[model samples]
Target chain A: MKYEILEHTADLKIKAYGKSLEELFMNAARGLMSVMYEEESSKEGKEVSDVVLETSGPDKEALLVNWLSDILLESDTRNVYCFDFSIHTINEQKISSTMKCIKSVAKEDVKAITYHGLTIKKHNGKLEATILVDV
Target chain B: MFSKEILQKVQKNIWEIPKSYREDMCVPARVFASERMLDDITTDRSLEQLVNVSTLPGIQEFAISMPDIHEGYGFPIGGVAALSVEDGVISPGGVGYDINCGVRLLKSKKTVKDIESSIVDLANQVQRDTPSGVGRGGELVLSQDEMDELLEGGVPWIIKKGYGLEGDEEFLEQGGRFDEADSSLITDHAKKRGRDQVGTLGAGNHFVEVQKVHEVLDDEIAQTFGLFKDQIVVMIHTGSRGLGHQVCTDYLRVMVQAMAKYDITLPDRELASVPFLSKEGQEYFKAMNAAANFGFCNRQVLTHLVRGSWKQIIDKKEDLSILYDVGHNMAKRETHDGKEVVVHRKGATRAFGPGHPEIPKQYQSVGQPVIIPGSMGTFSYVLAGTNESMKQSFGSTCHGAGRRMSRKKAKKVIDYNKLKQELDEYHVVARAGSARGLVEEAPGAYKDIDDVVNVVQETGIAKKVVKLKPLVVVKG
Candidate 1:
């Protein structure tokens, strides 16, 4: 799994090369938490309450947006800070994921998704998604 | 971002570039900003969208953007354009997803002096009476027929149902009624979202604040607005709620087909639009108007609740009246330059000057009142429209304190616990759907509203009437 920050803005483009799409989806969830608290240390003593989300899209870009939006909205609405996530992205049009939010007290709020530099591409050997989450 | 080649100074606070700036641009891109505000013009793709707005068919004059303009999905948040009704284009993105999300001002006879001791109770009462949070429904559940009447009748429908006040219809913009709405055009999904959401505060930058008239800038206009120093006022900032969101989501797909049918080519797919007078465009206009009417009904019903709470607390029975209600996000059909034009103002407020047939007879002598609300923990302003706005910017003005930082950044740095503590210390009661939401909307995340207000005042787009400070805020 590898990620690169896009130039000129706070956005990330990630590539997770795995034999199966499940591994790719889980890594993407980890990528999302890294943008905020970036760890599980504060969630050490907390019991896990898994929040599952199911989303589908006609295109990968829209799919990625719906997936991230679901997670972000759930985290904000529930007042749960997330550090660990496990996701299952079906090659079909949908992605199913279980998000675990850690109970931590710091960080910023996401305004909404911006269309600025949004891209999702399927390469020869890897699936890559680029998203700009408003800080 | 604007290339140095594309921009040239027209005068103070005004920048202009030719229609040839972009290949698809059909008119010049014009923006208003001071030397300071223009320094960060390249911060986002705002100028790009501003120029793209010029490409719409039948766009009259130049594409105009307010000083607080920032990049948004389809149109820049503060962008405005006027398209000819007969040949122009109507785009959903041009009005924004959160349609009719606007500000409503209500003034009470009970001053801050009278409510100081019971401020916390009042705030709590407001929070309890109004529902907050995402997917939060309300007490009133309307049937399909009632929903139709609400859409066509706007506030009058709510008023007739005993959830409105006397003189409210007159004081509100358009008497809280717009004849352009045809509820038959609204989709079942849109109606479903609004069925139980009236009087509820939807999440993200929406709130009901009990404010005190802190400063009277223009006394004559303040008097006309029935505001006095120390008087208590309530400002409800919200719109059609879930219904509006569904309306936009439903249309985005419809517009995709509309774009193909109309054969309109644009560089940005999000700006998918149909020509004015087309079946698709007229349907959207009608649907948008219906959502705007729903917004009026939402505010009207909320006002009745606030009035009841005010009456409960104050010893003396006094009138709490609606000062004005204006839609900051919308697209309207109006006559400009002797031609009927479709005006799309996304994240911008309409600032029609005096003597317009649209304004109520009472305010006809004082011009339209434009309510510009700041975020929670900040001062909101009431400004009156100016003739200069009608002549230069199609009777439009800046809406509020524009976002300088994203919501994600706000939640990251601003501590939610600390924010609640600080507000409590100041005796400003705060309530929210989520604690994190409170931090996400911290005043630090936005531009200096005073600066934004000053530009409008100096530019004569709108002049300040009275400054208001929040005593209690119910945030959702």
Candidate 2:
């Protein structure tokens, strides 16, 4: 499975898995989008817009948080819902990506991405991460 | 990793983990909970988080947690700490991501008997008049200049704009404005996020509820606050929406990077902070205050909306006055024990006792009004600050019932139809924008608010005044 929801007392948690780092990041974004758009109606009646984003962090965890934060910022300020993500290049310190944004409404407002008990690990030749989102 | 043996029982309802429990702890950590409540607290990392909070520099007295404490990012929810302003540090996590997320109570002239038949209509009207749910914008969008004024002037500016009633500011905490707010310190991105969100209630636990005073625990104090058994009141629970979240996110990054420069090391990166006197700290304080102003005005607009909704079914001239408004997540500079300290109340309420100059003159003989909302469909409470709270808890008390079960668990265990039927049994109406949201906030998800309030009262931090039962709930 690409992603699964975990139980949290006061927030939402998602566990994502992928065969590669890029896939892991992509799956995490998809998981967040799923939480934010729980209703199918939010996905209808919107034209897609192309957008490119570039950011770098000291490590992979920071990079993941930065990437998600950028998505949240764009979704709130630009009034667009992200439907898809494509990672062109990713390294230890930098990542470049293109995301497809659609004109849709959200069903939930994810306040911020938290770092509490945040970790990314590899097992059985696969990358996995458990991320918590403050709703 | 916390063992029960590490805690020393201080009293029937108090427990303490001495400074020696952790080598780096600068002060002892204390928790107020009954035996039953302590078991729930021990199921999570709240105690360990409290120990981590104790390690912060210049933390005076004790790092404390209320009975309702639960696991959070850094400091646990229902946490309290007082840091000496002269030598202390300010952590953004202490004030939480939602700056000034608070509750406001409005008392009406009508009683439950008068509004018994119209509860459903009132709930429907409130849900329609108030813009709610995710990505929903309100009718009152602000220009950049007007937004700046709101960030600084708070409810006063909103009142001048013909949104709220005049003299309403008198009933708010800090008169609904913080003098130190600096709009220039607020980022443009934050401004953009807030421009359309004012007067809107965002999703996930934010709500507007019509409540009835079912019981009066302290008649004298209830009378002083204009509350009587069977009176109908309105409660609004929300905060500085996206603007506050962005402000915290922006400052957390700054503080995380500044930690190394200041030669500071913490057990967790989420506890990133700077000395209160530092430039970065001052900038964060100013920006935080600005976001808090946004929260204050946000509630005021909702108050106006509630008043309008009430007018639709009741008399147009009927009075629905604000009893009190308090910010549960905040850091305020106050004088404690004759020393200047910045008290951080994450998921706690300020319960300053009688005669405190910060309260309104009319309430000086009593104490600051404290509103504690229960889980959806449960019993909420009204309490007053006490002198013992000022002495023991830095003038703070518990905020709510606190979560006992996770939202995911609630969704799994609770049948939505059955829950709706249960509310029907209580003569309560529940309205929501999403079905999943309602299940997530099921009454079974939280601890019993009565138990939480009893601990606070027994501990002498706050005294009970009244108990309110929800008659109608409108969720975002």
Best by DockQ: 2
Q: What's candidate 2's DockQ score?
A: 0.69
- Residue B62, model 1: Cα distance from true site in angstroms: 1.7
Looking at model 1, residue B282 earns an lDDT score of 83
Clashing residue pairs in candidate 2 are none
Against the native complex, each candidate's DockQ, computed on alpha carbons, is 0.11, 0.69
TM values, all candidates: 0.84, 0.97
**Per-residue lDDT for B199-260 in model 1, tens only?**
87777788999999999998888887788999989999988876776676556556755686
Name the candidate that leads on lDDT.
Answer: 2
Model 1 spans with C-alpha error above 4 angstroms: A1-118, A129-135, B1-6, B421-427
Candidate 1 at B99: error in angstroms? Answer: 0.9
A1-135, model 2: which lDDT tens digit per residue? 999878787888879999988999999988888777653345456677998999777678877877887788788777677866999999867899999887767777889877777789999999999888888
For B1-476, candidate 2 gives per-residue lDDT tens digits of: 46877889998899999999889999999999998877788888889999999999889989999998998888899999999899999999899999999999999989888988887889899999999888888898889999999999999999999878889999999999999999999889889988898998888888999999999999899999999989999999999999999998888877877888888888876777899889999999999999999999999999999899999977688858999999999999999879999999999999999999999887899899999999999999999999999999999999998988888788889999999999899888999998888998888988899999999999999999999999999988
- Model 1 in CAPRI terms: which quality? incorrect
